[model samples]
Target: MDSTPGVTIDLTVADQDSKRFGSAPSPIKIGAVRMHGWQVHPISVASDQFDGADAYLVKFNYELGTTPDTPEMNWFELGVELREGVVVDAIPHHTQPTQTSVSYIVNDHLNLVPATNGVTPAAHLPATGETIHVFGVGSSGVRWQYWATSDTGVRWGSRVAWLVTLVDQETTHLDLTTIVRFDQRPTLDWNVLPAVTPADLRIELPTATNPRAEVTTQPANGTTVALLPSSPRVFISYTHDNNAHKQLVRDFANLLIKCGLDVRLDQFASPARKDWFLWANDNIDNADFVIIIASPKCLAVGEGKIDRNEHPGMHCELGIMRDRLQGNRRLWEQKLLPVVLPGESLSNIPVFLQPQAMDRYEIDELTEDALGDLLAAIHHGTEDNSRSPVVLMATSARRALADS
Candidate 1:
């Protein structure tokens, strides 16, 4: 084992002249690299030339090893310096992992199976001609670093490089996928360099999109378990407390949407002439989870302190939630979640919901890390097991006794 990570580059395609360049449909040159005892294989690299725009779209698909000896690849960067005649028309976007797998060697036998647990690294175009994607393995979240360039000197051609860094020791793999667009047909030569010192760079703590699905381990026998769908239908229930509060709720909903949740919020609905009450009720019934954002106005409406005519929409939603919970306590209890935003208080939760006795998610900030527990609950249905049925019944009985 080498203390310093070793790098090996392997060009998968040998006949470069055989492949036609520009206008004519041709395959992009694909290559592989082995870094830190793990193999970085380019599964496919497809390129499409624009009809008359003289532009091209390239999609890269790469898979890395996931064995125990595989080093933790913290960040991966793709850079393209355009030729004198070419220019970058658009920044790279739409980066996500398409698939993930795990490999285990047991009893001198090699077994490869699909893994349910994996993180989708966040992609950022921090600077021109540079796109960096990073993922974290532990509690400490992803750290982003970008380079500063004042080198505006004239150059004849551009250079493209793919850099991967192994910052820690962990057993995880990443299936990197991204699409890049160029104004003109550019060279797709990806040069892998060993540990070059980045110049004029600054490390910053940036927010990352939540993983598409929560991480789950496969059984020791290499049995693949069914994982939650990538996008869960989530409905956000909250009162129009104020302009600021409404904006906060909207921001939270947007964040959930970015995390791959099909979020349903009143703010996102159109202002067409229709029955708002029916809309609220229908979404509540159809949603995978209805997140009840805790606030003073929401508590007032849920507890009947506010007049129904004042906030008919919130009133209608609360009525539907109450009916569903009374109809099926166990099911609705798991589906209806009480959430307190950063500036909100837990005491603002509705009384009939048994806020004191049940689990409530407190969001510390408007970041993915703050919503980890809520996301996990939605993905794994763990909240349903948080409290036993017997315990819930006892809590209801206690509430009844207290009211008497």
Candidate 2:
């Protein structure tokens, strides 16, 4: 005897070509009145030179048995879980619904962005315990796996699930699709679902036989593929002007972390007891790039005008930096970067660094775009080819003083 309320949910997979996706299972009732259906689709895109499958479309037609009084009753979520060796290349944004009876909203708390060519979206890789929400009307835990490899053609698997909230307080969470295997290849033309071409969709026969040989590579006209570079190590040197200023610096560091950079800050290491001088020396020595936050107080310290007893950390760091600059002028000139934050002026930069003559980054706002120049310098040396006169003069003067 079925005591659950009578509700109808017709699930079907449309626009699925037989070559890319296997037979889709019929809609099955999981718990109470919950219904689910699944299909295996490829996660990779194909091109003329290489044989791979492009993105596929799965049409979901959801209809509730009865309209409820509260708005919460209309909540539902669509999620995807990737198996081992599978990584999410791109995902379409669901901020705006295609067609829905009631008003729908996309939860961007995870900051998931639509996949665009040459642009890396946020929340693409979920940490070991992190949950990423691809599309949903309400919130729920969505788990997925991402692994990196150098193989061109790799076996990728994903499970799509749907969760519905019933008015009777009974929630239904079931796998909408089975584990679909596809050859994951690197492609620049990542088209979102519904816009993908049918000709671009085709699965390779005789999938990888050995489990260890998950991905098989096929050379495409001798095309060279480059792996993503490791995260750059950045050390920030800033003055403790005020609480607000400290907070601002902290926020800036966090944003850099979100952008996939290894940022080292004193604030992040304050929890453990440490020798301040050693900490400063180690970070400045090991960092690939040192970001000096330009401010009035920092200028005073750099110019040797500030009292030696104040801001011991800044004083020690500046001393080490000056020594390094004097030891290897050209190398230090490229490694040490001067940065002016919002509401700060270029004149605040230390004179020895040559604020007016050398390249200094101005961050108008704390965003990826605002940090573009700084990031560029850190990744690639300053575009300017001319040598800084101030640096040459300073080095000459130091040599003369040493001789005397």
Candidate 3:
């Protein structure tokens, strides 16, 4: 074991880990993880996209070698495996919180490592002859895989990072914040969970906030668990800028509803007595399809419109759509529909929505092509990618775990 502070002791040679990882690298590359740390830093990042959810996300970052001399070569990769929620919230040591989390760059790719040292480094796991016993802090491990740049020549490692939301979870101490390195993985049992490195580093911790699990499930903070009817529902999102244009959206909703769709419209879903914001969000959260009648006024309200703004209701609907479909290409393809109404330039569409295929129809010369496409797309039910078909990590669950 290297006596250097924060250095991980190298264990078991090439053959085993190579086979475990399905690679046959040399002994030098397999063991003796040179350097990693929970060294903290603040970064500007969007708060966990699904806000006000119970799940918390934390990032673990570290540097390679002791200096900039560490050789990060091609096909050389660094990844991390940890129980979800093990990375509870933390304000990176310095600077104000700006949706920050730990992060680093190994070679050119973003890489992940452990946050706390209480978790035993693989080198410290029980050896073959010892009584192997280990338990998990999370229901499953979260793995972030990274690969080296084969094309570029060897480069020194960059400080790695994870910009994650704060989370809270029940925790157990394996001899409270102990750092252990073992030769092999211990046979794990529930009674004794795996250990973690203590928060030994002297980075000032920020004031702990409420656990993400306790987050509010409202339209503003955001939640994905929909609240709409099971029927294929469509949400008419538009602006009331022009009287005739507003009627067009109303007519559009009526058309979809007449075709056996449960269409939710502003004037229809929101009675004057009802909270339009909440009503719009309900459909945005639950509706099967969202047809944005892309217009300058509608697009302006998407983000430029805020809480007290005239188009706050429209902003809520469109903003929620952006959050829900952030990285989900599958759902974006199914759940969101943008139609260019007459006299509205494509520039009216938000930058995020611009790349999407839009259905074009003029209010004065309305055609069936755009409307027909919208109908067909929404009729095909939204695909639930929530189920992890394999043992792989479920992003939804991980996301919740992330912010929790």
RMSD of 1: 22.0
Question: What is the RMSD, in Å, between candidate 2 and the native fold over all Cα?
Answer: 22.0
Per-candidate Cα lDDT values, in order, are 0.45, 0.44, 0.40
**Ranking of predictions according to lDDT:** 1, 2, 3
Error of 3 at 71 (Å): 79
Clashes of 1: 0
**In candidate 3, what residue range of length 10 has the lowest lDDT sum?**
122-131
Write down the TM-score of every candidate: 0.42, 0.43, 0.35
Displacement of residue 214 (Cα, Å) in model 1 is 37
Which order, best to worst by TM-score? Answer: 2, 1, 3
Candidate 1 — what's its lDDT?
0.45
Clash count, candidate 3: 37
lDDT of 2: 0.44
